[model samples]
Target: MPSASLSVKGRISMINFNTMNLRQENNIRRRFIMKKAARFLVVILSMMFLWGCELALIGIGASVGVGTYKFIEGKLERPYPIELQKAWDATNTALTNLQISVSGSLLEGAKGNIEGVRKDGVTVYISLKDEGQKVTTIGVRVGTFGDRIEADLVHKEIAAAAGL
Candidate 1:
């Protein structure tokens, strides 16, 4: 009788030890998952904050129908009071007048991108954005590294062509 009691006590202790170990493992796994999730959230929040700061600093709001011209992100952007199709046609004519051959053209909905290359191998890119209500914006970039003067000249030609 004494031996049987000892054996039962030993089995109960073993079961208790196994249950404790399982609980500990579950706690550790839960903590690990929580830590990983926290880290991921921190990274996502940081990216969002950085993007917001960039938009603020660049004054994206100031460009809407302001009809102002400025250089941003290596490109010259100008807002105009014109329709999308008209602006796109004028831009193509302006490039042609400047002796730039249109190499590629992409138009989707109310936006367009036109790429041209000069005889001297200088490339120019023109982007048009129509924000509805007769508010259109034009962005110009010249060459790979961007030439501000050339871009301004192209913009002037485009404005003339558009009768703006």
Candidate 2:
């Protein structure tokens, strides 16, 4: 009888130990899963936040008649619904009107660049690419880095000159 009692007690203790280990293991796995979920959520939210400005710009451009543009690196680019030749001529006129002295220029069949210097000695570069018929995209940059105000001014002048 005594031996039987000791064996039963040992079995009961083993069962308790096993149950405790299982509980602890389950808790660790739950915590790991929770941590992963939290990290994923943070990454998703951060991406959305980063894209907020781009989305807003798209919406604004869509609302306006001017198509969407992308500011890449230091260049602010825009598209005009005009022929490449028209756009090129308008660019020159715009720079001349803006009092930016043309330093150098190049015009190929589908790509071209116009470099000039403002009175303030800030270098301005305007690049043109033919997208399709009556569609030309222009990328403008001011100085070595970039100047949004100057770039925008250039774009605005180009648009006006192109009758866009």
Candidate 3:
């Protein structure tokens, strides 16, 4: 099969006529450069904002760790065993200040075990007493994903601390 072609000519106005003059070309180039600069500025500003947020978070963690430790020391009742009392004292010191102080207790028979719940920044893990009197083990389990103590993690932390 042979295809027949038809040819016609007029003013090719349908095509874009961009290469008219040097001034027009420069204007277009300037516009492109301005757009790119604006985009770069936006990106740099976004990065700076994120970096600032990260620094703020670190500062908060340090403040919480110190303040919570002090708060715990102030709250405990006297007359408990020296070792058990000291464990509580140390646990509070170790926690971040952002901790919500959900609930905590020391088990009767187990002198060293103590449990505590705190937000501790982003993730919520139940802090429990390890076998040793000095170290408090953080449970891998996460608490309820929200801002409350309804999560099963808190209950488990309490039970573990209470020696149940």
Candidate 4:
């Protein structure tokens, strides 16, 4: 029988089946979109967390390529294979070697901050964090914004002083 000539009950059932199918389709589409969005979010968050993670070999006089450091968000950071105390001492020696007069410094427990100014009057900030197991992470920032070259130079000095 033609759908148009179906009994009232039959017509209602047919309409309900179509409506159900549409609802199921919409739900499936929503789920697909949600899955894609979730995957995209995961990728973006991973990238953000690994922003300054670059592994480079450091020879006797190698530059900052694939070095044990990173420059992210105006901070050139690195995880040195040394303890906090040694890293702090290295930082001081590095500054002195570079003639960047230390204006202020604070070393407490496993964390430290050193503020200095280059000869040209550019402000420099360095932070040290202990990662346990005799590992320390150092972050360096130059000036209000960020100077990659200057930061690298600072890191080189620190690394040399630390004997890394």
lDDT of each: 0.85, 0.85, 0.40, 0.85
**Model 3 misplaced stretches (Cα beyond 4 Å):** 1-20, 54-164
Q: Which candidate is the best by TM-score?
A: 2
Residues 1-164 of candidate 1 have per-residue lDDT tens digits of: 35635577799999999999999999999999999999999999998878746344333543444346778777998877788999999999999899999999999998999999999999899999986777678999998878889999999999899987
Which digits, one per residue and each the tens of the lDDT, describe model 4 over residues 28-85? 9999999999999999999888765443222222232226565679998877878899
Minimal lDDT window, size 10, model 4: 57-66
Q: Which scores greater on lDDT, model 3 or model 4?
A: 4
Question: What's the C-alpha lDDT at position 155 in model 4?
Answer: 91
Report lDDT (Cα) of residue 148, candidate 4: 88
**Candidates 1 and 3 compared by lDDT, better number:** 1
RMSD of each: 11.0, 7.6, 15.0, 8.8
Model 2 is weakest, by summed lDDT over 10 consecutive residues, at 57-66
lDDT (Cα, 0-100) at 4 in candidate 2: 38
RMSD after Cα superposition, model 2: 7.6
Off by over 4 Å in 4: 1-66
Clashing pairs in 3: 64-96, 64-97, 65-96, 65-97, 69-92, 69-93
On TM-score, who's better, 2 or 4? Answer: 2
Tens digit of per-residue lDDT, candidate 2, span 38-125? 9999999988888847555434322433456777888998877777899999999999999999999999999999999999899999
- What residue pairs clash in candidate 1, if any at all? none
